[model samples]
Target: MIKLCLQRSLRPAVLLSRSALDPAVTVRKVPIVPHIHSCQMGTRGRNEPREPLNSPKSAKDFIYSLHPKERTCLLMELQSFESIAIAQETLQPTPPTRAQIKYVLFHNSIPFVGFGFLDNAIMIAAGTQIEMSIGITFGISTMAAAALGNLVSDLAGLGLAGYVEALASRLGMQGPDLTPKQADMWQTRVSSHMGKAIGVTIGCILGMFPLFFLSDDDEEEKKKRKAALTAPNA
Candidate 1:
């Protein structure tokens, strides 16, 4: 039918008009299909929704949303974008297990254990030494001595952080393998916070070992303060 139409259309204009005018011969209208030799008859598909052209926000979205046949219009080199390694986000990540959370808890707590102990112990020891040596001569307040001692402890922490981490690593208590989503879970975060809090509390309690070796000045001051508070003011 197409061949016949093409043959007749190729004829002289006089005969083509007569054939159209005569009712005896019928001229069939050629229906246009959606896709013909990779060329679409219309810009939008018949069944496809007429979405806004500005729907795509970026080049990637526009390209990814392009129909396979539509991609034929692109340059050969540009067409190779399909080969680019993009992140494949398919399956949902598994939630962290109890053991995994425990691992994270211990992994974080272990290193901080030494840190807390050292920070508290060093501060106490340093403060006491400062009071005995330079504080008496300079008439430095106990609060000032404590503040300077804390500074020394912080500086020491800054230096010894790597060593503490290194020592903790030798314990063979590595964190569990989990996705970012799993690691960010409330349970994991809670476990981490709890572990650090508990470790530091214990470390601070242990760090009070220095108090047993110190003079009874603090006790005497506490008694004096209590007596003064209880006594009537003039």
Candidate 2:
């Protein structure tokens, strides 16, 4: 009698009938179910479908049958296609904008009144009584005028700064990213213009200070002095 050995996977057959297996039969391994997946991909040159590697033959046999030149040509074609695809992706266009730069910033004119602090400081430094006198008159009158001027100037300055920032931001340059030199120059120019205006306004006010001390009734005293001096001459 021949000894027969069967594996566990084939136990269904064994369970069906005890005498089904011949005494001489030996089954050490069971056949595995092959997995098949199909992919439809376009190649470099032709748009037609190619035979799949898993169809009816083994992969090793298919690869061994290809010549060296044919393999190199296929690789080169695939590389060229990949390069073209990458180039096209890189060259895509950005969106356009219809809003103008000036429209986003200021409308046009900004008034240059003598209202900023820098202007006041410059005027005071330049001898305007508003800048010159820390005395009672200046303390009351000039201070109020100067403060009013500066407040107006400050509000206007804020608007100007906003306009500039909006313009820069629209052009893709954030306000904070401006170069240190550029920022310094902008601040300096704003300060300089405001200072000039304050200086002019304060100067005109200070130039008229002596007139306040002049008597409105001075003509009577002037006539009396002139009469006495003229009689001596007579």
Candidate 3:
């Protein structure tokens, strides 16, 4: 019978502890060492040996057990790894400044100005057409015509979104020099909201141009219709 024995070290040495069972067999002791490198411990001297650093406790124990000269060699190897980690962290990117966020907010507002103008213009024009073509013929109310116009406007917006994005990308303005994490902060979020509100408000005011071009006759006709409907006499 042959029994296997395992030696625990940086390089494991396996040996057979028992002799062969057969009476004629002769047993010879053979040591097998497996070399495994878990991590690079910097440049090592040919004469120096390596120790396993599996845990803080284990590393401390190994260092305390070493001779003074070998201990210094191991300390130098560990310091090399620590310096590399610090250098990597130092090279990481930093966030941008407040002024850069403001610049981004201004450019973001520009495309939305166009969107608000087109939305209101389309809604008013479609509502007018619906009032003339469908509401009068079918005896539908003005509110119903207006709601239908909004539905049409919303459908048009779905297709218009892609074109608006494409156009804005082509006509790109100077963007903020900011890291992605910095741009996603609360201050930037609030700035974007303010830009959208201001842009849409300005655009909506400009979109009321259609109201100026209406004929006096059309206004008079609408007044007559309302008067006739509200009158008590048959």
Using TM-score, give the best candidate's number: 1
Tell me the tens digit of each residue's lDDT in model 1 across 1-234. Answer: 211222332233323344445667555454322432332212332222334334334334444555666544432212122212112134566678988888878776786788788889999999877765556556678899899899888887776666666677677764566564665688888988988887788777787788888878854754565456556653
Model 1 ranges off by over 4 Å: 1-88, 217-234
lDDT of 3 by residue, 8-97 (tens): 221111112111223453445444333322222222222123355555565665555556555444444333333343333436644456
Instruction: Return the clash pairs for model 1, or none.
Output: none
Most accurate candidate by lDDT: 1
Which residue pairs collide, candidate 2? 115-149, 115-150, 119-195, 124-131
Per-residue accuracy of model 2 over 26-134 as CA lDDT, tens digit each: 5454343332221112222222233555533433344344455543443343333333433344364332222322221221112122223333343333333333233
Per-candidate TM equals: 0.53, 0.20, 0.52
lDDT at residue 10 of model 1 (Cα atoms)? 27
Better lDDT candidate (1, 3): 1
lDDT score of residue 53 within candidate 2 = 51
TM-score of model 3 (CA atoms): 0.52
For candidate 3, the lDDT comes to 0.56
Model 3 regions more than 4 Å off: 1-96, 220-234
Worst 10 residues of 1 by lDDT: 79-88
RMSD of each: 24.3, 34.2, 24.4
